[model samples]
Target chain A: MNQRAAILSLITPAYLWLALTILLPLSAMLYYSFLSDVPIGNREVSWTTENYRTFFEKAFYSELMLRSFKLGAEVTSICLLLGFPCALALAKSIRGRTKEALFLLIILPFWSNALVRIFSWTMVLRGNGILEYSINWLLPGTGPLDLMFTYPAILLGLVHSYLPYMILTCYISIDAIDNQLLEAARSLGAGKLTILFRLIVPLALPGIVAGSFLIFIPVIGSFMEPRLLGGRNGTFIGTIIEDQFTAVFNWPLGAALSFIMMGLVLLILFGFSPLVRRLK
Target chain B: MANVSVLNLSKNFGTTTALDRVSFQFEDGKFFALLGPSGSGKTTLLRMIAGFESPDQGSIHIGGKVVDHIPVEKRDIGMVFQNYALFPNMNVQANVGFGLRVRGISGSEMKRLVAEALELVRLSGFDNRQPDQLSGGQRQRVALARAIVTKPRVLLLDEPLSALDRTLRLEMEIELKRIQRDVGITTIFVTHDQEEALTMSDQIGILNEGQLVQHGSPVDIYENPQSVFVARFLGEANLLRGQADGKNVKLEIGGTVKTLSKPAYPQVICSIRPEKISIQKEQEVHRSNGNRVAGRVNEHIFNGTSLTYLVQCGNLVVKVFVQNLSGEVIPPNSSVHLFFRPEDTLVFPDA
Candidate 1:
């Protein structure tokens, strides 16, 4: 009984903090999602389901959501493809002080402000930017490659922002794998590709799944990078939601849209949960 | 099956030489053990043979072919690590059939071969069980099965039984020998456990400080160890420093020691195993053409089946092992006579 009391006392503060921060706001959002209008400054309001109906009935909202999900998938795939090899090199090829230094470099972007990082990408990606200048300098006769405010620019910023997550997760799992297993495979006549797919990839699947979830969920719900980097091509479900709250002052629509996106994300996660458990 | 031979194999990691100029022939279809303590380069030699680590100065020949530049997979050898190294992601059957599958052998042939290999290791009908589900001994068996399934030219085991418990280790020793004999593959096993090496291998090579100190059969290595390191490493040895003349040596402790073989140097150290020396109460009559010494019993240890008495002869405390057939215990401070045959005494240079 004393042990139980001690555990309860230790956890109660954290639980209360989470309730205040997450649960209370979520409850307010749910209530606001059902209202006809913003319940602020003594404005008259009524409980309604029109905000949710707007999301399902309109083709525009669903298309934007699909586009947002596509962007998330593309970013996740690119991150995984680029990050897994870096992680393997970091965890296996390099060793000692070099590995630690490389690891620090991989996570260095996280130390800087995300907004600053995104804006820095814009400066590098604009028409007369360092990338175009370098290409023109190398080729001696290249056109102005104005890559700013494009879909690729948003992808570049997001991948840079989230690549470390994939690499770190993969490095952790791959590093935990014993070198003896690889040697054993080689001794049993397994070639390089065989070792990678049969041994390393399967053993590192948990990290791949985890990294994918970490990158995908936030990218789909992201508004800042798409707005700053994508410009005219930046219209996504997240931007529409942002307009509903800050620009249009339609809190009910924003709340409903946030809940719908949460539901879809939860559904996607639920669909892949069985695969993750099997990997474990 | 192929005989593996290394010719003056040498390797150095930074300033420390991991393996010196070592050369040995591991006979085909025989179980050979590389026995040594830590930092003795036993594992490094094994890795060189397995093609995991290349030797810097020597060539490794498998089946009379110099395989110095061959990659590990192309070398066609199977190895079992100390940790077993079974793929945790694979089930028993998948793990066992990995080599065969990688070699493009599938369908009923793969199934039959995997089954036969598993049955050889005595882990049959465990097709779907994952590696984490098995015990340590069982995982080792699975690793063995996986290694031999592809019928590689040689099988290398790196201290595979050291991870098991005492009783399990003993059982696996016999089991491993049986499997090796049944498969009749050229096997090189590396281990630090002298007892395990002595019990299982057909040939034993003792190493110390990156050099091969001695290589012989188990009985021969035990009976004739050339240096003090091998004499003490393989088993306990009692050394007596003395001045030698031919097969006889005048001891500093006021007794004469004899050896069947003459010593080359005037100064010699005679080694005698504890069990070879017989102890009797000083009052008993003794008649034998052997070296005899009188000592006071310092202490005796009762080990259920045998008794070891620490006898103080002059300034030396000689250990003698006696069978506990009569259940007799010798009290401390009693006078005793220790007798050892001249043939049982081994002579080495004093250096």
Candidate 2:
């Protein structure tokens, strides 16, 4: 009993810190969602359900949420398709020092700040940037192309930022496969293509599911990619929430939108949990 | 039916040669075992025959056709891995039917054949269960069913019984021999267990250092080993290293020693199996015997059915086995006389 109490005492500090830092803030945000922001002469102090009501009544909020989901799905699917094959190649072909070097290359972009990584894509995709210059050079008479502040740029940055996560998870999974299983399949008269689909893919499915969740959730909540690259036609829910918090000073509405986003994240997790269990 | 001929095979990984120039032949429908320690290139040779490996320089002929360049799937060969590599996601039926399905046979015909193969290995009604749900012996039987379903021209087993328990390994060995005979498929098995090789193979090829040291029937290899390594490897033997003079060999033991048969060369080593040595009472020992040694038992081990004695003669300690009669027992630290017939001794060229 004394030992148990001592262990609990040692863990108490971290427990209190987590509750105060994480749980309390999230709880406060949930509470704030039910409150309404009113206009006073200089400041506002009112409590009502109008903020939640306004969000539910507006179709634009729902459209932004749907659009974010669509973009997140696209980014996740593209990352999986490209990342799985790249990871398989890396796991199978590279060895020793070369494998370490390739792994380092995959994770090198993560070392830089996220905003800088997003901005780097802008320099290349802008109207007068390297992509436009290349197109003009290749087509000769073609004028400069405009790709700045577009959906493609945002999608590109999302995939670029999250692909390493997918690849690393997939590499770890694929590397755990026993080489003898592949040989056994071949000996049973399975061709290389059959082995890939029937053996390798099924065995690596858990990694795919894990990578999907890692890339999808973050991409949906991302604000910088859409904010930097989305022009007049492009707007995501994350950017709208950012606008409400910083530019408009509408903390109650922002809190409502954040709660809605958290609900959507939970829904997405609910949808994916069955799939993860099935893969296992 | 297939006869496999490996001619002048050599494989090198980087600078280290895993297999030297090796050659052997397995007649059709014969159970051949390649017996060796690890790194003796037995598995490499088996892999080459199964078409998973291509030798740097060699010609392999199965059914009198050169198959050195053929891919594994095109060779019509079945292999059982040591780990019993069954597909984890598939049931036993699907795994057993995989080869048939690959060959474009499916539906009722595939089902019948898979059932028949599973029945042959005595694994019926296990088709619906996954591999992990089965016992080790059951899993091995499923692996065998999977391999034999396609009626392969040649069956290759790479240490298949190595993962099973001792009793299970013994039972599976008999099962494998029976199945191989019943199917009449030419089979080549690779194992490091000498007893398994001696018991199961119609012909045993003893390999050492990537070279085939001896290839013969189990009896010939065991009774007439051509090298000290073979005699020591196959079973227990007491080696007497001595100088060869004409047709007579001289031993450092306490008696006059003579060779049973003279080799063309001089300077030989002789090996005597422990079972061939007879222990006699002092009064029953004849003085005019061809070879006899005087020794005292240093240690005795009672092995249920037999007693093994470690006897010291002069400066050499020799092991001898005595069958236990109903009431016979030998205690340790007892005086004993060891005798052997001259022709039972094996003489090899000096290493």
Estimate TM-scores for all models: 0.98, 0.95
Q: What's the DockQ for every one of the candidates?
A: 0.90, 0.78
Clashing pairs in 2: none
lDDT score for residue B310 of model 1: 96
Question: Candidate 1, which segments miss by more than 4 Å at Cα?
Answer: B245-247
Query: Which docking category, incorrect, acceptable, medium or high, applies to candidate 1?
Result: high
Query: Cα lDDT of model 2 overall?
Result: 0.87
- What C-alpha lDDT values do all the predictions have? 0.93, 0.87
lDDT of 2 at A165: 88
Give a tens-digit lDDT track for model 2, residues B1-351. Answer: 788999999998888777899999999999999999898999999999998789999889999999988899889999999998999878999999999999999999999999999999998888799888999999999999999999988999999999999999999999999999999999999999998999999999988888999999999999888788889989888988777766777776746566667854566777899999987655556555757778877888888899888988878999999888754765666667788878877788886
Write one digit per residue (lDDT tens) for candidate 1, span B190-216: 999999999999999999999999999
lDDT of 1 by residue, A1-280 (tens): 9999999999999999999999999999999999999988899999899999999999999999999999999999999999999999988899899988998899899899999998889879998898898999999878898789999999999999999999999999999999999999999999999999999999999999999999999999999999999999999999999999999999999999999999999999899999988987
**lDDT of model number 1:** 0.93
